[model samples]
Target: DQQVKQNSPSLSVQEGRISILNCDYTNSMFDYFLWYKKYPAEGPTFLISISSIKDKNEDGRFTVFLNKSAKHLSLHIVPSQPGDSAVYFCAASPNNNDMRFGAGTRLTVKP
Candidate 1:
């Protein structure tokens, strides 16, 4: 069964604006949340990720927030650039052995 879901299949934003991607999971056992950005024909590249230990994590222009109680997570990209346009995936894992992925949300940044 699909435990992860990205309600919005796509998002559009202008350059210099912030982009927020949201994901929801039904599994409470998930302790790890990861965000990945995928370019056409290339494998998804790791973006921002967070563990249950922290409610939020920040890396450069990327940040991830987790609400354990709500079983929800969100990835935020500040001042999004055209290069940031890609398919983004949200993944949850209890451990490395089993990870679940949301279908993915395609983000388009227009200049």
Candidate 2:
């Protein structure tokens, strides 16, 4: 059974604006949160992540926030850029190894 779900299948943002991507999980045992960005024919690249113990994690223009109580997570990108355009996947793991990925949300950042 799939444990993770991406609420929105796609999102579009104007350049220099903020983009928010959301996901929800059925398993409460999820301890780690991760977001990945993928191009057409490339493997997914790690974007941002967080632990269930923390509410948020940030790296440059990307941030992943986990709301454990609601079993929800969100990835925020500030000043979204065209290069940031890609398919974004939300993933969660119980022990850092057994991870599950949700159907990705394609983000388009228009200049």
Candidate 3:
């Protein structure tokens, strides 16, 4: 069973527009959520994270909103840029060591 799921495999958005990515989890024990961005063959880098204790976290153009009741989370990027084109992964950790990740969502920002 996929503990975490990203329904869309890819998304395309125009530069300067907004890009939204969604994720859902079935594991209720997950207490920590994180978003990572990957480029080409490189490893994923941390983008933003939110704990189950909070509802939302934002950093500059990136924002992550978590709804514990619904077991859902989403990432929002404002003024999407060409540089934002990459694979985005949503991860959740109930314990400290093991983090479950979604297959990933590829975002293509067109200029």
Q: State which candidate has the highest TM-score.
A: 3
Candidate 3 lDDT, tens digit per residue, 25-91? 9999999999999999899999999999999999999999999999999999998999999999999
Cα RMSD to the true fold for all candidates: 0.7, 0.7, 0.6
Backbone steric clashes in candidate 2, count: 0
Summarize candidate 1's per-residue lDDT along 1-111 as a digit string, tens digits.
Answer: 889999999999999999999999999899999999999999999887899999999999999999999999999999899999999999999995588899999999999
lDDT of 1: 0.94
Each model's TM-score, in the order given? 0.97, 0.97, 0.98
Q: What value of lDDT does candidate 2 attain over all alpha carbons?
A: 0.93
Q: What does candidate 2 score on TM? A: 0.97
lDDT, candidate 3, equals 0.97
Across 1-111, the per-residue lDDT of candidate 2 in tens digits comes to 879999789999999999999999999888998999999999999888898889988899888888888999999999899999999999999999989999999999999
Give the higher-lDDT candidate: 1 or 3.
3
Model 1 TM-score (2 dp): 0.97
lDDT of each: 0.94, 0.93, 0.97
Q: Tell me the spans in candidate 3 whose CA falls farther than 4 Å from its real position.
A: none
- Candidate 2 runs further than 4 Å off: none
lDDT of 2 at 89: 97
